[model samples]
Target chain A: MMSELDDDLVARAQHGDAAALEQLLGAVRVVAVRYCRARLGRTVGAFTTADDLAQEICLAVFHGLARVRGPLITYMYGIASHKVTDALRTAGRTAVLHSLDELEGRADISPGPEDAAVAAELSAQLARLLATLPPQHREIIVLRIMVGLPAEQVGAALNLSAANVRLIQHRALAQLRPVANEILSEVNP
Target chain B: MTAHHDQHTEPAEVQHDEHLAHKLATGQPGLPQDPLSILLAACRDDIRAAENPAMPLLANAAHVAVRGHRRRTLLAIAAATLVSGGAAAVVLARDAQPGSPLWPITELVYTEHADLALIRMALGDARAAITQGRYTDAQIHLDEAARLLTRITPGTPAQQLAAEIGTLRQELAAHLAAPAQQSEPASQTPGARAATPASAGGTTGAPTDPGSPGQRPATPTPGGQPPVPPGRDRPQPGEQQRTTTRGSSRPPR
Candidate 1:
């Protein structure tokens, strides 16, 4: 669901305000980028980078802007989810996703060699752990962590009660502990 | 899926498990060097630096696209209108006598060599009649040209032709109202018919074609100069007869 601010921006954008359109798109860009990062796995190709996937989702959001109304973020998340799912299916059929250093022309990865290697291992481990969760639990973890959505808001977005969101999230994290230890133990030992 | 582990774990390890679960829920790490935080920061940096292609509002894009689509549709319609009209004009021009309304559409739509040739002949005859002071004959030609202008399809060219016809009509009307006014041409060309006043005219005196050099009709109106607005013409009484008339008649509709 949209925050009150996003809702207002969406309404203005629907009425043909160009500034509001840009603002609404900007608000969604980061969340959509994080969501794409979380869901796209460790594979990095031209279509696999968070930025590439986020651009795709934003284009889809703008294309469907006229047909939708209400909480802008939820509507956009739906688009992101659909695009991510489609990308996953396509990636499954296609074998290789090449790794890349630069995403958008000239952006440094910006971390030391040790920090980058550790981060990559953790990302691979987290991707596996997230994939193991039930779809609903996985969605909760992503929305809660990646989008930084509060439980009440996530509940509103997913049509689940706030209590249900907390319960599912607790169980998901409980399941995550042993797997995280396994990855850490492998690296340390 | 792992309920059997609950019975096997000791208290210290249970606390450790709780600590890890708590960290995951809060997006934290057990140690200061949390790789999750590192991953998040790197992704955020990359995303922030990457440029997004600009997009216009959907409604604006749709409006422009729809308008462009409409213009394409209209052009197709106009091209079809011209083609059908051209074919019709060919048949009619072959058989057209003096008083055909189809001549107007043909003259306006197809200004090809043949059509321009025919229209020029008619306009040239009208200009000749004006120089000869045949007001009635000139009025007939002006009336035909005016009527033809109305038949042209609504577009830019039609507007330009309409403006030209407007200037010609104003010049002809001014000539009819001010018979005493001397005109161009070296000879005293006797008028074929008397300049008759319209049944309802507002001019109380003869109107001069004010500022027109040598009192000539401003027909074949000068380029880069505005046509003489009828209101700008001064009503001058003849040099000898101080008598005036009122309520100058407007140019022929």
Candidate 2:
């Protein structure tokens, strides 16, 4: 169910209602972090931790909450989307390298053989395929498909028109089709 | 090689490819043996975990909001203090002068020079816009230049040069505010327009004897050089001269 907090909670939070504010933030954290991880995963070597980045998103939402007057989820998601995009821009290639380094550094952690092989193969393929799409296209696909934001909300969050969002989504899907087909074929073969 | 392949076989392949393309585009859930599913699932779990009520994410946001509010309050207080301090300084300076120190004149010159500089920048920006065929943007800069120049004060002599500078600025503003068809070529002379009134103010012409009270002094212009009458010796001693000129130009308010 969508979060039901209203403008009153937002106003109260602006006047320093910590509890109401926390409730508002809790409602949207799922979609927000998912959006961040997906967009960040496409980057190279991000140095900042995901939890830290998510915290930054939370801060931006709280700071900007007074100006946003809508359903808490929509407003929160909008703030989250902007924060995720900003984090991606700031982190650039570093995010991907950092994720890979983290994986490599965990020598004590043992994956089952099947899981390890699959993880390595999938990570390598994603790294290569993600490089093919433009940053904007990659962002929209991750937000809509992986993060599961509706088209209207994605458009609002990204500061794009809904029509533009759909158009970009279409282009992104078309571009991914051949890669998806090749991946399926390779796996089946 | 013995039996010819059916043409229908090629059509079937094309249809199958089309169907697969549609499925991929639609993101239909037919779980292919893709390994990324586990990773995707894991990421989904992380997202869910982040949403938990026990996490500190929400509490952190509350702290940040409080800090931001405090910072904004501090900035506003600082700005108010600065403005009040500046007004007090102006009052004390005025009281210390025996005769009317022409503050109005100085204000006029400072205002005029600033307005002129603004106009010049606007004109340059407009020229750039015109070249780019962005008439709307060019018009905006031109309008701002005009508004700045219209406020020029002309009569104050204690700040006479400043007023003159203001007049020149207004002139520049007027030029810029004209229709695109009438815009003048950029000024070729540096500080030329501001220098026009120096002779008329009696500061540049025949030096007044030091003994005379009403006579303009022949004191060597602040740069240790002979004074050129209006329209003549341009002060070229960089920022020092400009500062002295501004100081000498304040009008009796």
Best by lDDT: 1
Candidate 2 at residue B246, lDDT? 23
TM-score of chain B of 2: 0.21
Sliding window of 10 residues with minimal summed lDDT for model 1 chain A: A97-106
* Chain A only: TM-score per candidate: 0.80, 0.65
lDDT of 2 by residue, A1-189 (tens): 122245666666555454554455544444555566555542223212444455555434544455566655567666666766666575574767655755665333435667556544554455455566887777666666556565555666666765566666666655765776676567677
lDDT of 2 at B88: 29
Candidate maximizing DockQ? 2
Per-residue alpha-carbon lDDT of candidate 1 for residues A56-120, written as tens digits (9 for 90 to 100): 46545555565566666667778788888877786667544322223333234335566556555
CAPRI classification of candidate 2: incorrect
True contacts kept of each: 0.01, 0.05
lDDT of each: 0.48, 0.44
Superposition error at B175 for model 1 (Å) = 66
TM-score of decoy 1: 0.42
Worst 10 residues of 1 chain B by lDDT: B242-251
Give the local distance difference test score of model 1: 0.48
